[model samples]
Target chain A: MIGGRPDMVDDEHRLKMLMVAGLGGDEAAYRAVLGALARHLRGFFRRRLASRPADCEDLVQETLLAVHTRRHTFDRSQPLTPWVFAIARYKLVDWLRRHARQDALHDPVDEWRNDLAVEGGQEADTARHDVSELLGTLPAKQREPIRLVKLEGLSVVEAAERTGLSVSAVKVGIHRGLKKLAAQFRP
Target chain B: MRTDDLVALLARGAGTEPMAVPARVWAMAVAGGAVAAVALMALMLGVQADLAGKVSTLAWWGKAGFTLAVALPALALITRMARPGSHVGRLPVALAAPVAALWLAAAIQLAGAPPGERLALVLGKTWASCPVWVTVLSLPLLIAALAALRALAPTRLALSGAGAGLFAGAVGALVYTLHCPELDPAFVAVWYVLGIAIPTGLGAAVGPWILRW
Candidate 1:
């Protein structure tokens, strides 16, 4: 196991280094951060957009572009993640606005089908892994909120902002989604 | 996880990619600095005229030294506020005014202003007075110095403000020292104290509102 404080300090320093590099316009540093953040971005879009891969990719691109244009706005002293995610959240909202479909207003489901794919390999693992399958069984309305807020680690406020729902609406979606996921697991 | 493993993961997974700055931004930074310098010069002239009219009792050097002493506490305040982790946000900045005020008060007491004058007179005098012009001019020079720093402040208001304030105070004090008369504890306590206090107070109060993105 790694020691904690040093790791923390080191992480902080690396974060600073990334900010400095971005500020200084270093291409290598830019690519490094982009590569690292891509998974999170994809996950973010996946959870919020539900099944809309194209919309998610479009948002990811837009967010990246905003990051580029507003890079100078970043304070070298602040945390990089919060700032980036704040931008990402805003971009997601913008995306939702531009592409407002009749489907978006519906309740979010708790679809976790990808997690269930892991269960196909073995029966013993499958029983233990039923929770993932159950989560996948949730409706899209519930699944989307759960995936975005819980799996992707967005704050309720942020998830609401990005998904274009009221804070209470998002909370309820999570509550209902979780109830269904729990019931499915037991059943 | 091992330190190396965690490090690798972190390095691999940094916050986001670095964004390229356009040539225009750099040009804007330089242009902004130049403009601020010109405005500061005008303000400095006015300040000097105001100061000279108020403090006829003391020699030019005395007034200059007093101003420099008052400006010192700003250094600590500015440095602390400029760093990322600093909580020197709006409330904190507002809260900091009293400390600056206290420093100004201490400077005046230390400066030993002439017996006939009131403490408020020392601080309230315009920067445009005869010898006071020397100190007054420092404000513009301060503005110019800060203008250059603005390039670094696009999104980081508090840091930028702190950097600008600290820098202006330090440079202003240094210049004042060369031209200022010998230091008197009494002079430092009064004029110098107020000089720093007023600006810091203004900055603390106005910084948040003006700096928001």
Candidate 2:
């Protein structure tokens, strides 16, 4: 099922595989389709996570979970790569925020404030070092918007609403943020 | 770790998350869909008897298009209103069971009839046939709508079902406007409106109560 099929098969079959089998609970089919995605996603994270080897596995796991959860959104008729990467892009930004010690709404504000403000010892320093190294994976512009939006748990509308910028501009900020992250580890 | 190693590790490694699916939630969805289908069938049958005397008064396309226009939007809205991520995901699929049965009945009625004869058959069986495909296609749309709702964590079913109803209304109206014949706005206004309204209302009314899980 893997190498036997031609790589350039029509998008319809891929979508059918996803919809009929994937939605219908064919685990083998799900794995086969997602296997290619794993490689592509790994490459994406590798480029953004070169300096933060420790975080790569966690990032990849989180991204795959998202892909599994949101797989239905992939219109069966469209090319698979862009959809996969869009999810990957979102996951990557989410990881970067977690690394940077940003507050997410899901996290209790009091606990988060206590963890960041009070725990300022060597343990915090090492964790910060790892996160900052990951941050170094993306340029500052990319990191800043991600920190504000994803890490801060702001919706695109909310981010724009708060920043007094257009929603399109916020999306552009996220896009440019990714491009800059991609540029950091293009070797 | 090697890429292969990582892949294998993640592939085999135990998922830290739970795989628990709420059983009662799915049961309620299936049950609600059944109730909605039955209620809709009753409503349509009532309309058929009322319209039987006037079957020849309306044009052929007028009758069929009225049915279609109503069916398409109503189905779309019902499916759209059911959210994907919640327990209601199964509602569309469950609703499909009844709708499919109705479609089979309609197709059988339409089998030997000529175009002109078709209107009479539909008038007799319209209540039965139309809900099948509407319910079938709606399962997926319900899933998408629910996924969008998951993050919102709406506290009230009325709010969520209302959202689903509005979406169903708009989608139903738009789709009907495009494909259905505009013969008698009166016919369209009647059966077509029921076609859309019944399924949508069913989804909305039941969506919150059943999908609460």
Candidate 3:
């Protein structure tokens, strides 16, 4: 049922082509595949982690790293979606297991259902807090541009102007900030 | 970090990174493990004095064939499990086939033997030492295969470990055949199978911890 849809088939074909090319050392194709996968993985994690939306991006990054590092395991002849999603599913399960253990330690069994039922506004607030906390971990040079360009939706030029940095510096800040954020979840 | 940034970073290293080919990795593991196991068997137990004579016999071929049949399917199972979401379709059945065939042969052999000799046929001369030897010999292959699995991605950690163990154990038994003189079907059906099972159990038990990414 997964690849039965026409659009799904197109995605499968396109992604498989990109993945194959990527495996053959085509960096652009590799980047394109990862970019497309990021969109899909964001949706996948968001749906699964609805109760803890703050964790979706972390899980997405983790799965993306797993996919990138384990790309060699992918059979060139196979469809790309299942292989990619399988890693996603594994990361989801792994994340859930680790968090479940932590949740068990911090929260009583009686409050578990209530935690799951946290309302939308509260969830958004928590997500925002988590984003700021993540950004807070970066140095000012990286943090300010990431906040402005990524969180606050400023253009790179505007962020550079606001921070008194070159446009390239602002771009580098965002990139390095994002890289650091991804690395935080590595272990 | 934004997913886009992470993707960009990952792509930057793509062409420069050395990709591990699954087939090549596994082949090296199996080949290296087999060689190590054969050398270990030679050093520890020494080849049976009649190995040259035995190779031409049906019983020797049966033992080799049984171990091979099990090992091949187990290798297939582990290969399937190395990748996430890959089905191990019919492989379990294939792995079981040799044991079933051997057991059937053992039953027939027992039926034909005198009741007094039946126990001897089942126990053979080295019943206590056989399984133990097989398990010990499997260590190299188990370590090698698991190391290979570690380099790749295996989502079902325990199952993949068990597959590696099964493959290692069977290969171990195959190598053990170089030294084992007993050719009774029942003895192999029971003790050789036990030898393979030890590693399989060990693999399953340690899989979650060792195979963790």
- Candidate DockQ values, in order, are 0.05, 0.04, 0.27
lDDT of 1 by residue, A106-148 (tens): 4344224433453354332012323335557887766766667
**Which segments of candidate 1 are over 4 A away from where they belong?**
A1-29, A38-187, B1-142, B153-159, B173-184, B201-213
Predictions in order: lDDT: 0.47, 0.45, 0.84
What TM-score between 0 and 1 does chain B of candidate 3 receive?
A: 0.96
- Winning candidate number (lDDT): 3
Best by DockQ: 3
Q: Encode model 2's per-residue lDDT on A51-132: one tens digit a residue.
A: 5543454555445545554344444444555555655665565456555564454467776566566345422112222223
Which model is ahead, 1 or 2, in terms of lDDT? 1
lDDT leaderboard ranking = 3, 1, 2
Off by over 4 Å in 2: A1-36, A42-59, A66-78, A89-187, B1-6, B9-35, B38-49, B54-213
Q: Predicted candidate 3: interface RMSD?
A: 7.1
